[model samples]
Structures are given as C-alpha cells and as structure tokens.
Target: MKFISWNVNGLRACLKKGFLDFYQEQKPDFCCLQETKMEQGQADIDLGEGMLEYWNSAEKKGYSGTAVFTPHQPLSVRYGMGKEEHDHEGRLITLEYEKFYLVCCYTPNSQNELKRLDYRMEWEDALREYLMELDKTKPVIYCGDLNVAHREIDLKNPKTNRMNAGFTDQEREKMTTLLSSGFTDTFRFLYPDLEGVYSWWSYRFSARKNNAGWRIDYFIISDRLQNAIKRAEILTQVEGSDHCPVLLELDI
Candidate 1:
C-alpha cells in the first residue's frame, strides 16, 4: 500500500498549483493533508470514484485544518484528540481500518522567538498520549507535518538553526520521546545517514533554489510495522506550497 502526506499551507492555493495533477499521477492508496486553511463546504475535492474524503476544519476559519483522502473505507473515523483544548484547530484526524489506525496530523509551529513553545509542548504531550492509547489497540500509520527537525541532519544548517522554533531542545526531545515509545521515523529508519534531503522549504531567500530546507514532514509508523515498511521518500521535486510530499510504501 502507498501512503503520502503533505502540508499544503493552503489547499485552495495548492490546487491552482497542480494539486489535482499530483494526486492523479501519484495515485497513492491514502493521501493525508495538513494546513488546509479552509473551512467546511469550501473544499469540493472529488478525487474520482472509490475515494473517500474526510475533513476537520478549524472553527477559527482558514487558519489550521486537516484532511484525508483514501480509497479504503475505514471502519471508524475520528476528529481531533477528544480534548477541547486541542481540538479547536482541527489538527488531527484518526481513521481505524481493519489492520491499523491511520492518523493525519498537522503539528503546531512554535513560531518566531518560541512564542508558542509552551502550548506546543502541551500539544506534543497530548498527541503522544493519544497515539499511545491507539497503539494499545493496533499498530498506527501516522503521517504529516510534525513541525520539528529531530536531528542535525534534518535541516541544512542545523548549527545555525539550533534553538530555533522547530529545532529547539524541548521540541526535539518531545519527538525523541515519541519515537522511543514505540514509533519509528520511517524515512530516517530507511536512510539513517542520508543528508540534504528535505520535505519543506522556506519561500523566502530563494530557499528551494538553494535546496535549503527541513525534513519536518514525516510518516511515522508503529515500530511493529518497521519490517513491513517497504519504502519512504522525500519528494523534493514536487511543488505547491513551501512543503513537498513525503511518500511511504508499506507491505501491509
């Protein structure tokens, strides 16, 4: 099975920039999106027949949101983490299939100067707890923009970017805890020493042209599925928003 995740920044803008073409060409079994920046009724995504679409829009209008497109019909679908504090932004959507759960998440950014670090920490704790709870039932296939560069190799200039929002010690430690708890960072697990491959780039300063970017987006699966994972990649060539898509091929 093939799974792809991307943070589009804005779905509306992305569609104009070949979203449908990419969707049709790749034809993944499941396509998860983050930062949709759209509200209900605004998205009329028809990915042709046999595709099921699910959206969790933020109440705050065009701010933060998530969506999922899958050919496989899930047994159950859930939105958010079931906590009002964390549910407001529509950052999470969980789908339960026969074999496992598919979680699409858009993690919050810490923002410039670490403005939202405290709230982001709470989110990390809550999201990890939620994933752990689901792991108690079955394995998980979680994907999307995790918003953190867990290690030095994840970003081009890690030394200069250290202590920044996504590379802060606190955020990186949270990701460490998550992976140590039973999840595997699929891309890094497959290519631990690979360098300069990134999924997201800043539009400013012609970052993409220089290939300066961060591998913040991910497909993190339960460690039990490590052997089942076939391939993982950062599609740097594909473009729309500042971020590109990450693909995962799994035997399961």
Candidate 2:
C-alpha cells in the first residue's frame, strides 16, 4: 500500500497552487493532510470516483485541521483523541483498516518563545500513549507533521535552532521517547545517515533555496512493520506548501 502525508499549511491556498495535479500524479492509496486550515465544504476538493474523504476541522475558523482521502474504506474512523482539550483543534484522525490503523495528526506547535511548551508536552505524552494503545491491537501507520526535529541531523542549523520551538531539547526528547517505546521513523530506518534531506522549509530567508530546513514531518510505523517497508521517501520537489509530501510503501 502507498501512503502519503503532507502539511499543506493551508489547503485552500494549495488548491490554487496545483494540489490536484500532484494528487492525480501520485494516486497514492491514501493521502493524509495536516494544517488544512479550513472547515468542511470550504474547498472544491473532489476525490472524484472511487475515493472516500474524511475530515476533522477545528472549531476555530480557518485554523488547524486534518483530512484523509482513501480509495479503500476503513472498518472504523475516529476523530481526535476523544478528549475535549485535544479534540477542539481537530488535530488527529484515525482510520482502522483490516490490517492496521492509519493515524493522521498535526501535533500542536510550541510556538515562538516556547509559550505553549507546557501544552505541547501534555499533547506529546497523550499522543504517545494513544498510539501505543492502538499498537496493542494491530500495527499502526502514523504519519503527519509531528513538529519536532528528532536529532541534530534532522535540521540544518541544529546549533542555532537548539532552543527553537521544534528543536527544543524537551520536544526532541519526547520524540526519542516515542520512538524508543515501539515506533520506527520510517525514513531514518530506511536511509540512516542520509543528510540534507528535509520535509519542511521556512518561508523566511530563502530557506528552501539554501536547503536549510528540518525533517519534522514523518511516517512512523509500529516496530513490527519494519520488515514490511518497501520504500520511504521525502518528496522535496513537489511544491504547494512549506512542506513536501513524505511517502511510504509497505508490502502489506
């Protein structure tokens, strides 16, 4: 199966920038989007024939949201973590397939000055627990913009970005804790030591032109699915948002 994740930044803007063109070209079995920034019926997105769409929009207007488009229907679908605090942002959606569960999430950012670091920490712990509980039932394919650069190699200016929102020690360690528990960061698992590969670039300072970016987006699978990975990729050339799509191919 082919699964892809991208943080569109804003789906409405991406549509004007050739979102459908790329979607048609890839034709992935599943396409997951983060930071959709709009409510249902706000966009002219038509997956057209043979596909089903699921959306979880934030209660706030034009804010954080997520969606999934898949040709294969899932046995069950869940919106949010079933918690009032986290559910308000529409940051997570889970689709339970026959073989595994696919979760799309837009983890809350710590924000400038780490103003929201406390909330983000709570989210990290809760989300990790949520994922592990799902893993107990079946292997999982968790993908999205997790908002943390797990290692020094994950970002270009690691030294300067050390205390930044996404690269802060506290945030990075949460990712380490999650991975150590039972998940596999698919891209790193497949291409250990691959450098200068990134999924997100800031709009400021010609970041993408200089390849100064971070690999915060990911496709993390249950450790049990390591043998099933056929390919894991960061589609850097595809453009529509600050983040390029990350792809995963599984034998299962």
Candidate 3:
C-alpha cells in the first residue's frame, strides 16, 4: 500500500495552490492531511469517484484539523484517543482495517516560549498509551505532522533551534520514547544516515529556497511492519503548503 502524509497548513488555502494537481499525480492508497483548518463540506473536494473522506475538524473553525482520503472503507473509524482533554482538537483519527490500524494525527505544538509544553507532554503520554494499546491488536501505520524534530540531523540549525517549540529536549525525548516503544520511524529506518532532506520549512528568511527546514512529519509503523517497508521518501519538490508530502510504501 502507498501512503502519503502532509501538513497542508490550511486545506482551503492549499486548494488554491495546486493541491489537486499534486493529489492527482500521486493517487496514493491513503492520503492523510493535517492542519486542514476547515470543516467537511467547507470545500468542494472531490479526489475521485470512489475516494472516501473522513474529516476531523476542530470545533473552533479555521483551526487544527485532520482528514484521511482513501478508496478502501475501514471496518471501524475512531476519532481521538478517547481522552476528553485531547479529544477536542480534532487532531487524531484511527481507521481499523482488516490487517492494520491506520492512525493520522497532528500532535500539539509546544508553542512559543514553551507555553504549551505542559499540555504537549500530557498529549504525548496519552498518545503513546493509545498507540500501544492499538499495537496489541494489530500492527499500526501511524502517520502525520508530529511537530518535533527527533534528532539533530532532522533540522538545519539544530544548535540554534535547540530550545524552540519543536526542538526542545522535552519534545524530542517524547519522540524517542515512542520509537523505543515498538514503533519505527520508516524514513530513518530506511536511510539512517541520510541528511539535508526535510518535510517542513518556514516562510520567513527564504527557508525553503535555502533548504533550511525540518523533518517533523513522519510515517511511523509498528515494529513488526519494518520488513514491509518498500519506499520512504520526503517529496521536497511538491509544493502547496509549508510542508511537502512524505511517502511510505508497504508491501502489505
């Protein structure tokens, strides 16, 4: 199966900037989007005749949201981690398939000056527990904009970005804990030493033009799916939002 995850920043705005063109070209088995910032029916999105869309839009309009588009119908669909505190953001969606569970999430950002670090930490713990429980039932394909640079090699200016929102030790360690607990970061698993490639860039200071960006988006699978990984790539050339698409191909 071919899976694609991207943080469109804002789906409505992205549609105006060739989002449909790129979607048509890839035609992935599963397309997951983060930060959609809009509700279902707010846009005229027609990926194709049979493609089904499952959207989790924030109660607050024009804010954090997620959506999944696929031709396959899931056996069951779940919104959120079943935690009241975390369920309000529309940041998570789980689709239970015959063989695996597909989870798309937009992790909470720590925010400037670590204003939300406490909440972010709470979210990480809840998410980890949620994923672990799902893994017990079947292998999982979890993909989305996790919003943290796991290692120094994941960003251009690691030293300067050390304590920033996405690069803080607290955030990075949470990612480390996730990977250590039976999940595999597919891209790093495929190309351990690969560098200079990223999925997200800031609009300021010519970040994208200078290739100064961070690999915050990811396709993390249950450790059992490691052997099924066929292709993992960061589609740097694709443009629409600040983030480019990340692709993962599995032989399952």
Q: What TM-scores do the predictions have?
A: 0.98, 0.99, 0.99
Q: Could you tell me which residue pairs clash in candidate 3?
A: none
Stretches of model 2 off by over 4 angstroms after superposition:
none
Clashing pairs in 1: none
lDDT at 52, model 3: 93
lDDT of 2: 0.95
RMSD in Å for candidate 2, one decimal? 0.7
The per-prediction tally of clashing pairs is 0, 0, 0
**Where in model 1 is the C-alpha error above 4 Å?**
none
lDDT of 3 by residue, 132-228 (tens): 9999999999999999999999999999999999999999999999999999999999989899999999999999999999999999999999999
Q: What lDDT is reached at residue 37 by model 1?
A: 96
Encode model 2's per-residue lDDT on 1-252: one tens digit a residue: 999999999999999999999999999999999999998788788777988999999899889999999999899999999778789998999999999999999999999999999999999999999999999999999999999999999999999989999999999999999999999999999888999999999999999999999999999999999999999999999999999999999999
| lDDT ranking from best candidate downward | 3, 2, 1
Q: How many steric overlaps does candidate 3 have? A: 0
How close is each model in CA RMSD to the real structure? Answer: 0.9, 0.7, 0.6
lDDT of 3: 0.96
Query: In terms of TM-score, how similar is model 3 to the real structure?
Result: 0.99
